[model samples]
Target chain A: MENLKKELKEKIIEALNLEDLTPEDIKDDELLFGEGLELDSIDALELIIILDKDYGIKLDDPKKGKKIFESIETMANYINENRSK
Target chain B: MKSEITHYCQIKNGKVIFDENLLYEDKEVDFQKFIKNAYQFFELDYRKFYKMDPLCKLAVMNSSVLIANLTEKLDPKTALLLTNKSACVDIDLKHQKSITEGFARPADFVYTLPNISLGEISIKNKLRSENSFFIFETFNPEFLITYTQQLIQTKKANAVLAGWVEIAENDYNALLFLVEKKKGIALKKENLLNLI
Candidate 1:
């Protein structure tokens, strides 16, 4: 779970172009959408692709991703539970 | 009072970036290679202009290079004067294709507006100054010189990036100069040809 959290943080930084940030800067329990990283709708699209490509989870609705991707903790939990492959 | 071209650079496909003194007879650009280099150089990995809008791409390419070369930072008061011949023709074609086809990409529609390229540059650089886009069959030195001088005289801008940026279905030519009321030589609007 901790390794997944670290990997998720790196993916978020790369996919969203958080250029000023390093993977170690992101906290596992910090909010992903707003205060923690200041991500937006476009970041959400990128996260959807990360879910599909890495975890084999296809989110049909981006809104559902809000609950699934609220924080690094929430995301790792969801992916561990629902990953198809 | 008049502004001068302190520094400038222009480049065609696979050529060394140079200024106006270096004559470039070759007008051909490897569109595929140019597009690829531009994407890599600018880090614009997004799906914008993937269908090959040469004009839009030219704007992005030149602005990227220019910004990279600029020694000074741009602000809201910086005036941007963009001159182009074919303004968003590629976008127009895409819009027509969408009408004929079942689905029109909404993103293409957004780029169809005539001044979109200019707006894109301004947004990319966060420049909020007086920006203008002009269309002409060829370079009008008289108007170009006059307008640039007047903008500075009127205090609309501290610096002006003025030039002819012409692109077609597959070709592009950019003549760019950074003008400011600083430690640069001054020339009358009528003497532009001689100065160039």
Candidate 2:
């Protein structure tokens, strides 16, 4: 779980082009939207693609991304259980 | 209705020249490096700019300089009109290659359309007016003049940001103008062509 959380943080930074951020900068429970990361709708779509391409976890409905991508901890937990690749 | 060119900017030959003055000139011949240097030279903080494709990046960089000197608040009704010869064909080919290789990047995929630059500009400047992108065989000042005049005369927009932005194979050119109802050179096709 610790390794997955770290990996998820790195991937999120790379996927979103957060050049100024590092894995340590993202708190495991930090909000990914609004005040925390301030990710917008387009970033949400890109996160969906990341889930599909990197983990082979295809999310059919984009609305589900809000819950799944709430934070680094949530994403790491979901991917650990669901990642096919 | 009357309109004039308030400010303008051009990016060509690895330089960002604003209002007839050189703002940035990169020693590196690399296109990406030059863009990064220009962005840094201006001290711009818009993080989303790093994610945009080259074409959109050029548009955003050019427009940022064009509007830098304006003291007045940017009217939300300001319209943006841009023309390009290639119309994002460079990025289109790259996206196609990605698909053919069985991995499509979402970042490149989102910029396949030419008009996406206008959206980027609007989002950065907080302009909420109508915007359009036109593809042309070559730069046509007449089309820009006529369309911009119509927009202003019909009260559809209080001002218009119109010009040509083309980026292909490490070469790029952007000649943009801010036209508003102000006292300056009368908005004419000849004036627009001369500025370019």
Q: Write the per-residue lDDT of candidate 2 for residues A6-83, one digit (tens) a residue.
A: 888888888777876889999999999899988888788778877888899999876778889899888988899999
User: What lDDT tens digits, residue by residue, belong to model 1 across residues B99-160?
Assistant: 68754544456668657777767777788888888988766777777888888888998888
- Per-residue error (Å), model 1, residue A52: 20
Q: Candidate 1, clashing residue pairs?
A: none
Predicted complex 1: CAPRI docking category: incorrect
Q: What are the per-model DockQ values?
A: 0.06, 0.45
Q: How close is candidate 1 to the true structure, as a TM-score?
A: 0.62
Measured by lDDT, the strongest candidate is 2
